[model samples]
Target chain A: MIQVEHLTKKFGRIVAVDDISFRIKKGEIIGFLGPNGAGKSTTMNILTGCISASEGKALINGIDILEEPAKVKKMIGYLPENPPLYGEMTAKEFLHTVCDLKNIPKPVRKDEINRVMKRVGIVDVSGRLIRNLSKGYKQRVGLAQAMIGKPPIMILDEPTVGLDPGQIIGIRNLINDLGRDHTVILSSHILSEVQAVCERVMIIAKGKIIASDTPENLSQHLFGSNRLFVSVAAETAAVEKTVKSIPDIIEYQIEEGEEIGAVSVKMKAAENTDIRKAVFSAFAAANQPLLMMRPIDMSLEEIFLDLTSAEVEL
Target chain B: MIAVYKKELKSYFYTPGAYIFMGAFLLIAGLLFSLQNVFAGDSNYAGFLSSLIFIFLLVVPILTMKLFTEEKRQKTDILLLSSPVSIIGIVLGKYLAAVTVFAATLLITMLYPLFLSFHGRMDWAQIWGTYIGFFFLGSAFIAIGTFLSEVAESQTSAAILTFCGLLASWIIDYIISFVPTSSMAGAIFILILAGAAIAVFQSKAQDWRISAAAAVIAIAAVCILYIVTPDMLYGLISKFIAWFSLTSRFQRFSMGILKLDAVIYYLSFSAFFLYVTGSRIENRRWS
Candidate 1:
């Protein structure tokens, strides 16, 4: 539903967003993953028409954002990094104002406002001033504001940034529900949150998109080696030797354990290779009892660090 | 546009800005009304109204200081700009909201004239004319304030800059008297103005070609005017200053002479400033 081609944004001498191109299919929940100052917010700003791009074009459902901003902007509901809000106004009043600005039909505005407020779990605080609300509620109010018009496309920049764990889970569930119908694009520095909520992840660094793929695929592709941790009732050196004898074992590390006569060994296997049975048989031949053997699936945290740190190296 | 207008108007009251603006203006107007009309037994309400222009130097900044600056400070402009509304709509809505408050305050002051009407003979035409002029003049000032607010980074700076801008306009007549009236001085002044315009253009467009072309056109036009009517060059400095003399135009209205040209001039003046305000906002997105 959205196509950004050769998008570039420059602030005087500093290039905020380099030549970045990506396509977002309808109903796809895409995560913009990057550290602070990695052009994630800049890319979001350009896509939503909040700022002009120095070069290239953005299209929403075949409509050019720049050529016909009014028309294209109607289809998008954007929640900026700060959640543009009027502190003096109540949440209800703010949403009403947003409804009017979005040009929603008058008859449905009230119902739409109520529905959005309830959806974001801000219904009880609707009448209270936004300034008086807690940060989590304020963030929910911002989310409600973005969802008010029920626009087909929603661009939320760090929607769950300031929320508590419960609020974060609520917001994640809300985003998951939203992804069923709306084309959602959310940005965040939190890898687990993005992995939990987004179907596709775009890892951005240094104003460029380093990788974009499914969360599982990103973790797997970036972590090509399969790792297994094993604790054996044998000497450290003997355990290392036994694990290294496996045909596909790429590397192994042995460390002394706290328990008497016990040693812990970590084994690394080649890409997509399952060395579980091989290691079991090798230790069995050595007459070494295996205390524990567990495969380690690369966590999103490892993937994020590896990808971002790898970019730093490049 | 109407939504933005209503929301902005409500915001003034929701915050302390609207009440403060109204209270401050009424205090000044009440003091002037009592001193000039009630104490002196003068029935000329237009004079009092004319004198109240200086009050705008203080209250107008209060009314408009937060128009765009506060939005930016709060980051709420993102909501407004990302919506379907046009930038012109947003600017005009906010501008009209400020003017509406000014008009509401001006409406309350009509009771001062009602009291004069009960106590003495009143010139209804002159009072109406002065009120019209005051409305337009105040609207123009608000437009200037709106433009100033867009350019300033904070509410304090916007308020201070607006005060300085309005004060400059108020003192422009006094400043004009000290300017050199000789034709050579006028020629030099026009050249300096042209140079400033060229510099502004160069910085904005970042292109020497456009600035050079503009400079050439300006110089050529001035030369042609000098050769064609050398007499027009005489006292040109005063005339140039007079063009910006918004107060001078108000004089005709205060005299109960509602000149169409003056009305058009005031309106176009406000419109021009508002247009510049809109363009500045649009330019910010690109920069």
Candidate 2:
């Protein structure tokens, strides 16, 4: 339930958020993928009403941010990159303060705070000062703060940036769970996290949205070559020559191994080609035993790099 | 707004800022009351109250330094700004919180006056009137400190800038004496002030025509005023400086003469600063 139209933010001479636009439907889990300084945070700030845009406008449920920020802000729960925490305050106190600022009814404030704390798994540390908690716990508290108001939209910027692997997974699961009812727009440089958690991905670079699609489609669209890694009992030169003879084999690299008579060859085939059959037959005709052959699916990391780097021919 | 106000008030006590501000203020008031009234055996509580203005130079910063600077440094402002709370709510909450601490501390020092009432004759009406003026004056200073804190980037800078700002206001009466009283100097000063306003407008709107027209209008107004009312420009610079001299207005309170204009002036002064602080915060979101 968000609409952004040609939003731009400028800091003095530098345009932090270039002419960018996007929309999120209700209950959609959207991932904002971009390298550092990609204007992801700027866009999030604009959407959350934390900051204003130099041009264009953002609407939360058709409430223009510039015209009626307080109303729109009530619908958004923003967890900034730094968490916006008061380290001196205990978790419970912090959440209570957030509830108050959100104008939650006094009757339900305590229950709402507890519910969010339980959701983010921070109930145990509610009595501890936020400064005494670890980074992961602090992040959970930040999440708890955002979820306290039960707002329909949650904008989290790098929610799991410094967390350990287990904590990251926990947060990802929490986000996925939250996505069932609330619209989520999360930004992270961690490609796999976004790929695993987000339903749709928007890849931004230099303040521009270069690509937007489903995570699977983005990976598949950016990956133009099918790679097949094969370990074969054959001479390196002969294996390379045979693989190069395949009709659609675009490139091949052979790695000589310590094993006296084996070679590992990585072969690249044209997009959508089944090169395994051709390679197997080619090796079979030469009496070279194929030890292993497997197609290498491009990882999200590679696709993210390919999408964000300037050299990518969008 | 109420929520923010409550939370802000609670935070003052939760942190060391309120304690430090109150403790330092009471200590100074105690020392001053003893020295000016008890040691001297003088029954004039107004003199002791008048000397307490110096305490604001130190403790006002403590009360207000963290109002906005700490929020910015901690990034907690994002939560406040992104919430349903208006900028005015946030500013008022912070201002009232600081004022509350100052008021609470001032209340503790009321014991000094009670002790005086026990031992000797006391002018209760004058004492109460002076207190009202002092409260308003302190609120105005805290507002100025709040605005200074918002303009400064770091807490240390905010504290230091607020101290300097309060110091300037403290010495404003003296500084006014050195200002040029000639009509020519006043006209030139007015022109410079008008130019600064036009420059601010140009920076914001980035429209040369509008700023140019504004500049022409300002200069023409100044020229017409100079030609029509030559006597109005005499001592104009001193009058302008005196108008901003917060302490000069505060003197009426210490004299136990609570003038309506002075009370309104102190209130409007505070409102003006609070408005500036709110605008600065809103401008930050756009910039």
Candidate 3:
């Protein structure tokens, strides 16, 4: 529902968002993955019509944002890095003001505010001043602010930055629920959370988009080898020799195990190769017992580190 | 626009701003009312209202210190700017809310004339006329305060800067009498204004060619004006300062003569600053 062309943003001499373009489909939960200051928030700001791009254009539902900002902004619910809230007002009062700004009809404004408060689980504390609310509740209030008016697209910047574990899970679930109807474009530096919720992920680094793909596909396409970590109850040299003798094994490292008389080995096998059976037979023939063997896939964290650090070109 | 106005007006009451502003204004007005009209036997109620012009210089900054600057500090401007509302809507909404408070307080001070009504014959025309002039003048001051607050980073700085700005405008009328009235001084002043305009244009357009062309056009226009009427150039420096003296126009309404041109001038003054404030905020997205 959104398309950007050669979008660039300059804050004086520094180029905050370089010439980068991308499109987001309706109802797609796209995760903006990037490290700190990687133009994630800047891109979101431009997309929501909160800020203008120095070059090129942004279109929302085929309407140029610069030409029709009021219309485009109406279709977006933006939660900036810090939620724009009034501390002096209660959560309910704040939502009422937001409904006013969003032009929710008075007949349904109360019901709409109730729905959002319930969705974000802030209904109980709705009567309390926002300044007195905990950070997690305030964050939910921010989320509730964005979820009001039922805009087609919801852009949240770092939705889970300051929260306890349970609150994190709660917000993640809330976002997942929002994903059913709203096209959620949430930015976060946390890879695991993005992988858990996003159908597609875009990795940005240093004001440029380095990669974009599904979480599983990104990890698979960037990882060149499968690895195995095995702990054997045998002499270190024997474990090393047997692991080296396994077929399709490119390289292996053997280290003294934490347990006595055991050797731990980390071996790299060729891509798509399964060497567990061969290694089992080799150790069995050498009169050494296999204690533990597990295939290790490169996690998304490693993929994120690799992508952000320019380890591979996507 | 109404939504922003309602919310902004409501916020003033929700916080201590509205009461404090009203309280300070009434305290001073009451003290002046009793001291001059009641005790000093000064039957001129319009004169009492006239002397209260200095009240704006002291309290207007307090009224508008947090209008936009507080929004920036608390980051609530994101909500206002990112909404469907136009920049003009936000600007006008806040401006009108402040003007409403100012008008409301000015109405409360109407009790002073009512007191005079019981004790002496009153020139209702002159009283209301002066009230009208005072309202417009205060509205103009509030517009400047709103613009100052928008440009400043914090409420304290906005308040201080606004105070300085209003004080300067207040003092400009007095400052004009001491200025050189020579035609050469007028020419120099006009040229300096043109130069500053070109500098401002250059920064905004980022094109020296267009700015240079504008500078040339300004200089040419000034020269043409000088040649057409050399007499007008004499004392032009003081006249130029007088043009911005908001109180000088109010002095007429205080004399019970409602000049339409002065009304338009005051309204235009407020409108001009309000327009600049709107554009500055809109330009922030690009900056």
| Pairwise lDDT winner, candidates 1 and 3 | 1
**All DockQ scores:** 0.86, 0.85, 0.84
- Candidate 2 docks with a DockQ of 0.85
Kindly provide the TM-score obtained by chain B of candidate 1 when compared with the true chain B: 0.92
Q: What is the lDDT of candidate 1?
A: 0.90
Off by over 4 Å in 2: A257-260, A310-314, B198-228
Q: For residue A24, give model 1's deviation from the true position in Å.
A: 1.7
In model 2, state the lDDT of residue A131.
85
**What's model 3's lDDT at B201?**
81
In the range B131-224, model 2's lDDT, one tens digit per residue, is: 9988999999999999999999998999999999889989989998888899889899999999998889888789999989988898898899
What is the CA-based DockQ of model 1?
0.86
**Candidate 2's C-alpha lDDT?**
0.88
* Candidate 2 residue-wise lDDT, A166-212, digit = tens: 99999999999999999999999889889999999998888889889
Model 1 over residues B77-97: C-alpha lDDT tens digits?
999989988989999999999
Considering TM-score, which of the candidate structures 2 and 3 is the better prediction for this target?
2
